[model samples]
Target: MRVLVQRVTSARVTVAGEVVGEITPATQGLLALVGVTHDDDPAKAQRLAEKLWQLRILDGEKSASDIGAPILVVSQFTLYGNTTKGRRPTWNAAAPGAVAEPLVDAFADALRALGAHVQTGAFGADMAVALVNDGPVTVQLEL
Candidate 1:
């Protein structure tokens, strides 16, 4: 499991021109782009969720769990795109939707279970994500 975490003031996801999920926090929030691979499991997803919640990348080095921050979760299979071979990228490293979708849901659920307000983009949909990045802070986590 991997997550690209970005601190944001606000974030939203649109699918087919319809808003699917959004988060506008009073202070700061997170836009989590989650990805899964063949070896990833629910345990790894949960662990990554915990790590994201406690990660101290926000203002004043506060964590999302510390500030009661909201999080926007989006499925991002492309994170595993392999471009090492040639001009063309390969998706072989990314888990197929059948295996990934449930794990993505588990990650979000884990965050929610940790008491963070969470929003999610529709899995397997073509989505447009918009966000105002706070401090331009971004972090990448893998488990």
Candidate 2:
């Protein structure tokens, strides 16, 4: 499992020009881009979701769990891209939707269980995401 966490004041996901999910926190929060690989299991996804919820990347270095901050979750299979030996990026490491969608939902479900308000983009849909990045802070984690 891999997650790219970005601190954001607000974030939204749209599908077909219609807003699907959104989170505009009173205090800064996170925009999590999740990717699932073949090796990732439900437990791993849940753990990473917990980690992101408690991660202290907000102003004054507070965790979202501490501040009741909201989170926007989106599926991004491209995080496993491999471009080491070619001009084009290969998606071989990324898990197929059949394996990935459930993990992505598990990640979001875990966050919600942790008491964080979680918003999610439609899986397998063409989405346009918008966000106001707070502090321009972004972190990547692999578990």
Candidate 3:
């Protein structure tokens, strides 16, 4: 599993012109783009969630857990895309939806279990994501 995390002042996801999830501008939050690959399981998802909750990339080096920051989780299989061979990217490293969707849900659920408010984008849907990245901070985690 891989997660591309960005510290955002605000973020939202819209599908078909309807907002499905959002983190209001009143607060600083993290936007997590999660991806799944072969050999990934629920345990990995849980561990990643735990790590994200405690990660200190927020203001004054405070973690999300310390400030009770909200998190927006979105499925992003493209994280595993490979382009080492040719001009075109390959999706061979990404897991299929049947295998990835539930794990994405597991990741969000784990964060919620850890007392973090979590919002999620629709899995396997045509969507648009918008965010104002705080400090332009971005981190990639994999397990």
For model 2, the stretches where C-alpha displacement exceeds 4 angstroms are: none
Best by TM-score: 3
Instruction: Write down the TM-score of every candidate.
Output: 0.97, 0.97, 0.99
Superposing every Cα of model 1 onto the true structure, what RMSD results?
Answer: 0.9
Candidate number achieving the greatest lDDT relative to the actual structure = 3
Q: Candidate 1 clashing pairs? A: none
What number of clashing residue pairs does each candidate have, in the order they appear?
0, 0, 0
Give the Cα error of residue 3 in candidate 3, in Å.
Answer: 0.4
The CA lDDT of each predicted structure is 0.94, 0.92, 0.98
Which pairs, if any, clash in model 2?
none
lDDT by residue (tens digit), candidate 1, 1-143: 88999999999999999999998756689999999999999999999999999999988899999999899999999999999998999999999999999999999999999999999999999999999998899889997
Query: What TM-score should be assigned to candidate 1?
Result: 0.97
Predicted candidate 3 versus true structure: per-residue lDDT over 1-143, tens digit per residue = 99999999999999999999999999899999999999999999999999999999999999999999999999999999999998999999999999999999999999999999999999999989999999999999987
lDDT tens readout by residue for model 2, 1-143: 89999999889999999999998656687899999999999899889988998898888889999999889999999999999996999999999999999999999999999999998999999999999998899999887
Please give the distance, in angstroms, between residue 74's alpha carbon in candidate 2 and its true position after superposition.
0.1
